[model samples]
Target: MNAARTQTDRTTARSPRPRAVLAALAAAQFTVMLATSIVNVALPQIRDGVGLSDGATTWVVNAYGLAFGALLLAGGRVGDLLGRRRVLVAGLALFALASLAAGAATSPAALIAARALQGLGAAAIAPAALALVMESFPAGPARGRALGVWGAVSGAGGAGGVLLGGALTEAWGWPWIFHSVALATAGVLVAVVVCVPRPPGGRDEGPAGRFDLLGTTTVTLALTGLVWGLTTARGAGWTDPRVLGALGASVLLLLAFVVIERRRPDALIPPRLFRTGRVAAGNVLMALLGSVWIALFFFLPLYQQQVLGSGPLATGAGQLPFAAANMLGSSLAPLVARRIGARATVTGALLTEAAGLLWLSRMSADGSYLVDVLGPSVLVGLGLSVAFVQLTAFAVDGVPGKDTGLAGGLVNTTRQVGGAIGLAALTTLAGSVTAASAHEPLREALTAGYRSAFSASAAVLAAAALLALFLTRAGAPPAVPPAAPAPRPLTPEPSRAP
Candidate 1:
């Protein structure tokens, strides 16, 4: 009782500024998200240092991705179970330590392991931080402003990572990429500890129940198999024994996961949420949009580096337009969403994205960045910015406040998992396209591959827009917009009494 009361005191005290917690949360989000791009600029050096083949080195990036994306949902649930602040701090600390391990690693295996650890930490931190923001701010203009700042920083983090990675790689070698993450994230972690308040209802981590351990196991194995199948489809035919067996195993495991969720007292993926159109639609779109995004980052760099003969740093720089546009669009999204309604905003955004993707597909041996890149960027930027901001609001509409964190998790998980699948498929398709152009010079072939991939990506984004249209309920009066997301999970919230 005493402990519970003390926690209650912390929630009600009002001593620390709420905006301070918001500030801390935003910075933490930016720092951790930088992990998404910090490795891109160092791909060459790390490839050389670790003696990794092209396919294998992809894992150095995907290891963190696989871990972070797979575990995001479970991480969100964990935050709801433990105190959010405690989890955030611990995640930051673990992330920093993992960075240190990655930086000093001497072997390929060590580096891969460290990267996985970093993902694990990120899984914990990302959701917890979002939950913190949701809890810290009320759901209105204040939350909107906070989310806008969060979104801009989120976009900027990618640009920052690219620039920083290039600088570090040039000045201090590949290990410096890892070292920079460690040093920067640690500082943010300290600030978070000092500022963010504990949950209001005390250690509000509800009673510990038996987690869906079986469901978790099956899902993990299933995704691992799927990724494996996708990864080696180039070397090993899709019909090859290894590939077929893994994919077949994945289906079986996923089926088992569904059965497990149905029987468990506490399910891993609660089916009840899917009954709501907003939750279900948001999740599906998140997955598909993620695919669009991963495809762009994967191919855009190749376009600049392999085709244009730009170096790694220059390749990173080429992405600046998208990043900057994403920032501008995100910053302005709430206003747009408020005016048009979240659903309409999402639709418009999707159309914009489709237009951009179609234009982007025209890349050639000598493509026009000014014509091809700039115009498409406007569409991509406006579409993504609008869609992301609005889809987030759509995710929580009519959801009971208590389910906010889970709601957040569902959407975020779709994005992470979809990205994994998208990357695998797009890379495979690009390889086939490039191989078919064997008569062309190596650079020419590579450019052909990027063009094909970019076109396909645009189609997917168009599909996502169409998907968003049917997923949301039509004709409902627009409610006030909710705060958006950058990281993978939900924020805490006050109850929504009718």
Candidate 2:
């Protein structure tokens, strides 16, 4: 019995702890998110240091997002084929190196290039990390809880990025932001290497098919064109020749991609995946929600700084309430979903967010943060966080194990693409409204523009809530179809002495 007990202790010591694995995965997720927003506060300093032109300065932010969004599908497919853990480690290493390069860059072009490389790494990390989470926890209460934790960390990362960016930019300097990310990411990478187990099967285990090169190229380029066009439209106007040309090329390329996907057996995004109503509806609603989510972060900071005369640090600090509420809501999502079901929970959350946006639309030119920002921010935070958790679950609910990475990528892609389009359109609308109100004081005109954007966002969320009612069934998620055979156990085969 003592020998047996000793044997058990050795076995346990050799195994990876589940909580440690989750923590490592969550840290990777947080690092990816932090890279996205951390640069916003440091842009001015970076611009000054790099001697960036106005156009180049914009690209500093856009470059990261564009690469991240465009390459997600390809990245996910690569993970599915190459092995998630292998891909994850590779991505983290690349991200860390890119961050280091970004921090040490002296030229505008070098910084932008490094940022894009960072995005490429993030595209690999996000989907692989999420897919690993789903794989780690089986479907049911455990999965739901894991997802809640995932959502909470994601929300916190965004807010933390801004706060950290402000503090670091003030205390250490702009480059520290990237250096800090590099340090944190390197730490996460080591934790992952230590804590996460290898894939159940060998690293090469995946669906038996060749990569769809043509389909991938077309879709990636199409997404790139679309995102670039939208981003260009912000400064160049929708009717500009360049914008029109890019949009036209994207539309054509997208059509070509659809045709190629239909013909190819090993398509990047299998058409069959969308046969389930939940997958389609979930992505749609997520897109809408993402529009508001990204827009809120962008415009809220601008309002605080421009209209309320708040400094960057104060603006970052003010988001604390929203961040706290977001984390709380994410934590509670599983419990709420268990009681009311995911569909109902999603609808309710959308309505709550809409209500908050509507309230925020009434902000005055001379309004204080207490009366105008805090209450609405709490509501929006709670609602957005809960909705995101539910929608994410919905998007991948019945997906096959073989395509889990693809589903993760798909959901992320929609959110990023929607955010780009929404931000551009709303920015344009706000500019137009502000121009129309030029007769008023500058502050009042700016407030009017912001109010209009908020009102429009509220309407969009309300529409999304109504759509959620129709798109999903009344009960629990539909059952998953028979998937490909599960991978072998993580234990390695015994080796014979030579």
Relative to the true structure, candidate 1 reaches a TM of: 0.89
Q: What ranges in model 1 sit over 4 Å off?
A: 1-14, 200-210, 234-237, 275-277, 368-375, 474-498
Q: Estimate each model's TM-score.
A: 0.89, 0.93
Question: Model 1, range 31-128, lDDT digits (tens) per residue?
Answer: 76688878886887998987878767877887787778777777776766665678778889999999999999887889989999998898888777
**Worst ten-residue run, lDDT, model 2?**
489-498
Q: How many backbone overlaps does candidate 1 show?
A: 1
For model 2, residues 1-498, the per-residue Cα lDDT tens digits are 999779656755676776787889999999988887887767788899889988789898899999999999888888877777888899999999999999999998899999999999999999988888777766666667778888888888888888888889888999999999999999999998888777433343545567789999999999999999998998899999999999999999999998998899889999867755377888999999988887888788778878998876887888889889989999888888887767789999999999999999999999989989999999998999899888888888777777778888899999999999888888898889999999999999999999999999999999999999888874445322222234323232221110
Which candidate tops TM-score? 2
Model 1 CA lDDT for position 33: 66
Q: How many backbone clashes does candidate 2 have?
A: 0
Distance from true position, residue 440, model 1, in Å? 1.6
- How many residue pairs collide in each prediction? 1, 0
